[model samples]
Target chain A: MHELGIVFYIIRDVKAAAAENSVQRISAVVMNIGEVSTVVPEYLTDCWRWAADKEPLLKGSELKINMIPAVTQCQDCGQEYETVKYGKTCPHCGSGNTFLLKGNEVEIKEIEVPNN
Target chain B: MDKVRVIEIKKSVFAENEQDANALRQELKDRGVYLLNLMSAPGSGKTTTLIKTINLLKDKLRIAVMEADIDSDVDAVKIKEATGIQSIQLHTGGMCHLDAEMTRQGLDGLDLDGVDLVILENVGNLVCPAEFDTGAARNAMILSVPEGHDKPLKYPLMFSVCDVVVINKMDVAPYFDFDLEKCKEYIAMRNPNAKVIPICAKTGEGVEAFAQWLLEQVQTLKH
Candidate 1:
């Protein structure tokens, strides 16, 4: 739902970064998407297809999403493990005493572009 | 002809939004207005809370509102009619969440010289609003009892980012099997520091407590 808005921001940032570095055309935008984030990767790509076409540098650029599994660290037992899905309690100590360690990221880690 | 390992620059994806939100936060603080960005699902009684809050604290504080919606000014109109307060309704067209730029525009339209508290009623969506920081001093989220107790688990980011949590629609607790304890536990588990207050906006139960807490938060920001 809000993936489109986020996609716009991603494109905006990547373009700005690319322009700053004198990159002419973006080939791909790499993202680290947390499993727990509400953004759907497919929907994001769909939005990318539409929004990127308007910009010359990103006309054919592809959005590459790297899915990160949701992992949590138990505060009580000091154990760390991947959650079953998005909100499964820690399996090691059965403690709701867990904090999210990763898998909430929605960041563009890198960008690939043509250097001219 | 393929030679060098070009440029390697690592930058944040949300740099622009982050920058804009930071500016907005500073602006609000400079104007001596405590801003609270409110978020919740649709039909969560956010408007009712605002109405009740205005009634309770209008005499003691100079309060204004910026209401964000997708298509309607109905909520803003309601707030104005009920409280006689100055409120500007921002229609984001089709956007689900309000961004820093939008919030800045709204703030520009406001008279903040004497405003003590400014409340931004975010679009009725839990997930997106949490991601966009509108430079507010605090992020407050509402969860209605009818929406169920599993909300904190399903929407962890919203709960985790909240400085205050309002469990609205408590009057319906007798009819619905809403687990109040579970809701509190879930919110506490997600965010230990968030202040959770239960309210029934329809019956005006706990509205006074909510207003008092909000007033204290604003007072703290003044110092």
Candidate 2:
């Protein structure tokens, strides 16, 4: 639902970067979406296809999402576990004191431009 | 012969928004306006809680509100009728959440001349709203009793980002199976420093303490 706004942000940033690099056209934009980031990859791509094509610089550009697994570290046990599976509690020690280590990324990892 | 080249940008999609949020934070800090991004699920009594808090602190502080909704001026009207404070309704045009730029636009529409605290009642969404920073000095969320106590387990990110969690609608706790302590434990698991305040917005219970907390946060921003 909020993917369209994010898509616009991505396009803006990509356009700025493309201008800086003197790139005429971008072929694809790769995103590193985290497992728990609330950004649905399918929705993002759907929105991107609809919105990105409107921009000449991003027309026909493909949006690829790379899913990053969310991990949580338990404070008491000092062990990491899958955040999506165990949530805030540590499965290894049943400890509630835990924090996310990664997998909350909503970043653009790479941009592919047509090479001539 | 054509070749495909991939640029190793490795930049965050949220980087722009983060930068905007940080800039807005600095601007607000310079102006001595403490911004609070208030979020919650639909029907979590965010408006009621805001009204109650306004009533408690209106005399002590200059207050303003920006109500963000998909397409409704209902909340803005309600806020005006209740407190007569400066209020602006932001129509997100089908967007589920307000990013920092959108928030800055809303702030631009407001008359912040003497406003000490500006409360942004974000669109009623637990998932998307938690993901965006609205350049608020403090992030607060409301969890109603009927929403169940297991919400933190299911939506850990929302709980994790919140500075304080208000357990609203506590007046009906007798009818619901919501466990306050258990919910607090869940919140603490994700964010140990998050303060949990139990309040009934309808009855104004615990609103004074909530107001006090807000005052303290505003004071902290002053220093």
Candidate 3:
């Protein structure tokens, strides 16, 4: 549901990037999606396929997602664990005082453009 | 012959929105209007809580409400009739959440010169709403008793982003397996600074505390 909204943002950013580089058309847009970012990559791709086709710059351009694994750090015992597998509780020391270190990203990594 | 080349443009998707939200917050501060972005899951009593709080503070503050939804004026209408204050609806055009740009557009529709406090009823959803910054002076959310205390664990981003977590439906807490203390603990675990105010919006129990908290916030920010 929210993935469609995210698709619009990606398109806007991709367009801006295209304009900055004087790129007439884009080949593909690569994104860094996090495991805990709450954005389903499949839904995002589906929405991208629908919305990207409408934009002339993004028409036929693929949206590539690079999945970033979520990691959590425990303050009590200075240990890092997988966020999706262990959650808030630290598996090593069993501490609830844990925080996410990464994997909340929905970032546009790069844009592939066809050059003559 | 067309050679495929990669243009390095590493940027967070929300970076632009975050910048816009910061700028909007500063602008609102300069204009002396406190924008409160209220969010919650559907059926979490956000409208009811707003009605109760607006009625309490409307006398002290000139408030305006913006109801953001995919498509509906019902919340906007309900707010206008219940509080008898200035209220307007913002259609998100099927978007799950309102970004800073949408919020700015919504604010443009209202007369901000005389308005001291502007409360934006963000679209109902705990997930996407928390991800986007709406340029509000403060962010608050309602977590009802029926939603379970584990919501904070499930939706850490939402809990972490909210400044205030209003525990609505306290009257029905006994009927549900909701532990107020445990809920507060989970919220604290997620956000150490988040203020938790328990209230029963239906029975108007403990609403004064929530109202007073809001009043003090507006006074502190606007004054």
Candidate 4:
């Protein structure tokens, strides 16, 4: 349900970028999807394909996702580790006092248009 | 020609929405309106708790409710009939969450004049609603006994983002193996500052605390 909503936001931003740059058509929209962004890449592209084709400027445009690895930093031990594997508990000192360093992004990296 | 030109955006999908939410928050503050975003799973007794709390504090503060759902106005009607305050239903049009713009549109439909607090009953989902900022001054959630005490562990982001967690269905906690102490512990783990209030919305036990919390929040925000 949310994937389709996300796709709509992407299309809106892409269309705005295209219009501002005077680009006629978009070939692909690259996204930086984090491991813990809660957005599944497959669902996003599936929704993107359905929603993007409705607009003439984004017909057949591909959504390329770049997965970012999640990392967590332990405040107690001053160590960083993989968020997916260790979660809130820091592997270094077995401390639950930790915060996510990154990998929570659902960012649009760029838009690509065919060079005329 | 197979050659392409790239337009660097490097913007988060929620960036614009977050900005809008902040702007709306500023506007709400300027108008002395305290907007509370309430979220939870579908059967978490959010509406029940809300009804109880509203009745308790209605005399002290001028309040309005905006109920957001994928369809139907049942909750809105329920609130209006039960509390007799101004309540409006917002149709999300199949979206799982309500963003800042949707919240603003809902606020526009209401008569904000002389209203001190606006409570937004967000779509009942722990996942998607946690992702979007709805421009509320504060965020709260309800966790029922049947939903288990491990909800914070499962839905970490939702717990982390919430300012308060209301533990509803306390009267039935004995039958369901719902450990109130463990529930508070779990909520504390996710959010150290989140205030937890145990209540039985059915029997109207411990609802005064929630109502008091809301009253204090509205007073602080307005003053």
Task: List each candidate's DockQ score.
Answer: 0.44, 0.75, 0.79, 0.79
What's the C-alpha lDDT at position B214 in model 3?
83
Task: Give candidate 2 misplaced runs (Cα > 4 Å).
Answer: A71-99
TM-score order of candidates, top first: 4, 3, 2, 1
Scored by TM-score, the top model is 4
In CAPRI terms, model 2 is classed as: medium
Angstrom error at residue B157, model 3: 1.2
For model 2 chain A, the run of ten residues with the poorest summed lDDT? A1-10
Give lDDT: candidate 1, residue B215.
Answer: 94
Model 4 ranges with Cα > 4 A deviation: none
Task: Mark the regions of model 1 whose C-alpha exceeds 4 Å error after superposition.
Answer: A75-79, A85-88, B1-9
Question: Compared with the true structure, what per-residue lDDT tens digits does model 1 show for residues A57-79?
Answer: 88988888889898888898888
**Inter-residue clash pairs, candidate 3:** none
Q: For residues B68-154, what per-residue lDDT tens digits would candidate 2 score against the true structure?
A: 999979999999999989999999998889999999999999999988999999999888888788899999999999999999988
> For residues B105-203, could you state the per-residue lDDT of candidate 1 as single tens digits?
998898887999999999999888988888898999889988998899888889999999999998888778999999889898789999989998888
User: 3 or 4, which is superior by TM-score?
Assistant: 4
Tens-digit lDDT track for model 4 on B78-103?
99999999999999999999999999
Winner by lDDT between candidate 4 and candidate 2: 4
Which residue runs of candidate 3 sit more than 4 Å off their true CA positions? none
